[model samples]
Target: MDAVPGRKAPMASGSAPDLMYCQPCAEDGNKILPDAFCPVCKEFLCSTCARVHRNQKITKSHALQDKTSMPSSFCAESEDEKFSVTCQHHSKEFIKYYCPRHDALLCGDCVIENENHRSCMVEKILQVAKRYQEGEEYISLKTGLGQMVRDIENYILYIQVRMKSVDEENLTNINEFRKFRNEINQYLDKRENELLAEIDQTKRTSKTFLNELKTKYTNIKSATEKLQSDLHAHEANSNQLLIVGKRAIKELEDLQTALEKVSMSKDVSRYTFDRDPATERLLASETAIGRLKEGESTTTLGQQQQKQEKKQQEQRKQQESKQQQHKPTQAPSHKVNFQSSVDLSQSQFSRQPDIPMKTSGDTRNCFLSSVACLSGNRILLADYNNQSVKLILRPTWCCPRLLCQVDHGTCVNCPVTGQPSL
Candidate 1:
C-alpha cells in the first residue's frame, strides 16, 4: 500500500508472510495466535484481546466472528497500512484527502489546518489508493530498490579490489627499482675495471719507448768516449789519429740526425681523461636510474569498466526491443471491418520508386517481384532487377525510402542509417 508519506524511497520486494499470529498481538510486539476475527475492525484478535474488545463501549454493538469461522492465518499489514484509514495528525478523524504532489495522506482537519493543502490539487484517498500496490510504477519501484542494492555491493567490491591491486603494484615497482639499481652497479664496476686497464696499458707503452731511446743514446756516448781516449793516447803530431777523429765526428752527426727522426716519429705527447657529462648529470638528479610512472593501470581499468558498461547498455537495449516486438498488443474494443477500411478495387501509382530502382546494378527495368503490407498503411516492395527492398509510404504520408540492398554478384549492400539489418 502506498500510504507512506515523507518516505525516501519505495520498499524492496518482500517474501510471503509465513508466521501466523493475532494482528493485535503482533501490533503490540507479541506472537499469540488469533482466537476470533473482528469484521468491522478487520483485525485478528486473540482470546484475551477479543474479550476486552467485546466489552469496549465503542465496539460493543459490532458483531464478532466465531473461532471456527476465522481464516487459517492473517498476513501482517505494514506500518503504513495501520495508519492508512486514519491520519496521525488528526487522531479522531478518518483519512479523507491525499496530496498528489507531496504524496501525503491527510484527514479533513489536516486539510483545513494547512494552507498549502488548500491551494494544491488534492484527491480522495479511496479513489487514488485503490489497487495502488498492483500498479506498474509500484512494481518497478520494488524492482529498482533490489537492483540498486546489488549495484552498490558490486561497486564496493570493485573499489576494494582496485585498492588491493594498487598496493600490490607498488610493492612490485619497489622490487623492480631495486633490481634495476643492482644492474647499474654491476655495469659501472665493469666499466671502471676496463678504464683502469686502459690507463695501465698507456703507461707501459710510453715507458717502454722512452727506455729504448735512453739505451741507444747511452751506447753512442760510450763509443765516442772510448774513441777520444784512444786518440789522446797517440802523439799530438800523429796523422792517423787526426784522420780517425774526423771520421768519428761525421758518424756522430749521423747519429744525432737519427735520434731527432726517432723523437719526431714515436714520441709521447699528451692525453686527456674527461668524465662523461651525461652520466654525471644523471647521478646528480633525484631520479638517477628511472622515474616512476603512475596511473596507467588505473586508467586502463577505468576504460575497461566503461567499455563493459557500454556493452551492457547495448545488450539491455537489444533485449528491450525484442520484448517490445514480441509483446502482445490488445485488440480493438470495437469490431474492425477490413474489407470496408481498405478498397482493393482502386488502383494507385507512386513515381517515387522510378528514380531509386534504376541503379548501376539494374541490367533491366525494375520489376516488383513481391509486395507486403505493414501496419500504418506502409508497404514493402522487393525489386527483382536491383535486388533491393524499399519501404513505400501510404498516400497520406510523403515518400518512399530504400531500406536495404543485397549484394547480387558485384552490387554493394546498402542499408538505411540507424536501421538494423534484416
Candidate 2:
C-alpha cells in the first residue's frame, strides 16, 4: 500500500540493471558512489578518476563540498529560514540581531530570554538599525569615491614625478654631453702633446744628421783644394829638376809616384765624405715622420663596439617610447543644444561642467563638477558659499545652463522655500 498506488512493483535497491556503471571498475556509477563528486557537474567519481581530474590546475576549485549536499544561500551565522532578517543597527547580516552598544549579535531566543537588553527601547533600536543600513550604503559610496580620488591623485602625482624625473634626466644628459666634450678636448690635447714631442725629436735628429753631413762635406772640399795646390807647385819647381841629374832622375820618378798616391788618397777621402750613410738613414726617418703626421683612419674595436651598442640602445629606447604612448583616451565632449526638443512635454537636466585647459604644448588639464536633478525640471545651482540659489532657466527651455557664484557669507544647504533661497 505504500507503493505508488499499487500500480507497479517497486524495484529492488541493488537490482536496477539500467543504472550507469563505471567502465573501468564495473561498479554502479550512481549508487556505488565515488569518494567525492566532480565540482563542475557534481557527478560522483572514483578515486582514480578524481586523480585524473585533479591534474587540471584551473579546475581545482570545482572540488566536491564536504557533506555532498548543496550549500545554502543564507548567511552562515543565521538559523532563520523565513522573514530574511538583517541587523538594522550593525550594518552587516541577513538574519542576525546585533546590539550597537555592545557591537554583537543575538539569536531569536536570546532576544526573548537575555536580560542584558531589557531596558533598551526597541523602536529606537530599530531606528538605529535603519540608520546603520543607510550608513553602510553611504560608506560604500564614500569608499568608492575615496578610492577614485586617491587613484586620480596618485595618477597626477605619478605624472608630475615622471615629468620631473624626465627633466632631471635630460639635464643630467646635457651635463654628460658637456663632460664628453671636455673629455674629447682633453684627449685631443694629450694626443697633440705626444705628437708635438715626437715631431720635435724627429726635427732634432734631422738637424743633427744634416749638420754632421755638412761638416764632412766642408772638410772634404778643403782637403781636395790643398792637395791640388801641392801637386801644381811640384810640377812648376825649377830647383827640383837641378837635383834630378842622373841620380836625381830616379828621385824625381819616386816623388812623382808618391804624389800620385797622395792624389788617390784625397779622391778616396772626398768620396767617403760625399757618400754619408747617416744622411740616407735620416731621409728615411723624415719619411716615417711624415707618415706619422697623417694618422691611421681605420676604426678601432672600441669605436665599432660603441656604434653597435648605440644602435641596440636606440632600438630599446624606441620600444620604450612606444609603450609610453599607450594610455587611456580622453572623455568625449558633450554640447548642449536647446533647439532639438520642441515636442517633449517634460524636460529634465542636471547642471554639470567639465572644463579643459591646455597646460602646455603637449599637455592639458581638466576640471569636473557634480550634477543633481531635482523636482519641477527647474535647475538649482548649489553654491557652497553664497546663501542664495539662482534659477538657471525657465521651464520652457529644454536644456539650460546653470551658473553659481560663491559669496563669503552663505550656507549651501539653506532652505529652498522662497526667492533667492535654494
- The whole-model C-alpha lDDT of candidate 1 against the native structure comes to 0.66
What lDDT tens digits, residue by residue, belong to model 2 across residues 1-422? 11111012435788643332222233332334344454444344457656665775544556654335533211111134432656454334343455655555654445566687655433323324535644666689889999999878877776787679769977977787778768867976997798778767767776776676566656555655655555555666656534434444454566566556545542212111243586468556855212213334434445657988999999999888667645443342243322321212233334535322223332322222333334566555443333334434334323222212222222221122211222
On residues 1-422, what C-alpha lDDT tens digit does candidate 1 reach at each position?
Answer: 34322112333579543444566567557778778888766667889988988997766766888688976554444544544466788777778678987888888788889988888898866445543645677889999999998878877888899899889988999999999989999999999999999988988888888888888778767876877786787657579778877887887787778767666666775567889999999979998799887654554445778988999999999998778756664443232232321112333433442334355666777888765546775777788877788776655322222122221212211122212212
Sliding window of 10 residues with minimal summed lDDT for model 2? 410-419
Which residue pairs collide, candidate 2?
A: 39-62, 85-94, 88-129, 89-129, 416-422
Q: Which ten residues in a row have the lowest lDDT in candidate 1?
A: 406-415
Number of the top-ranking candidate, with lDDT as the measure: 1
Residue-level error in angstroms, candidate 2, position 76 = 41
RMSD versus native structure for model 2 = 30.2
lDDT of each: 0.66, 0.47
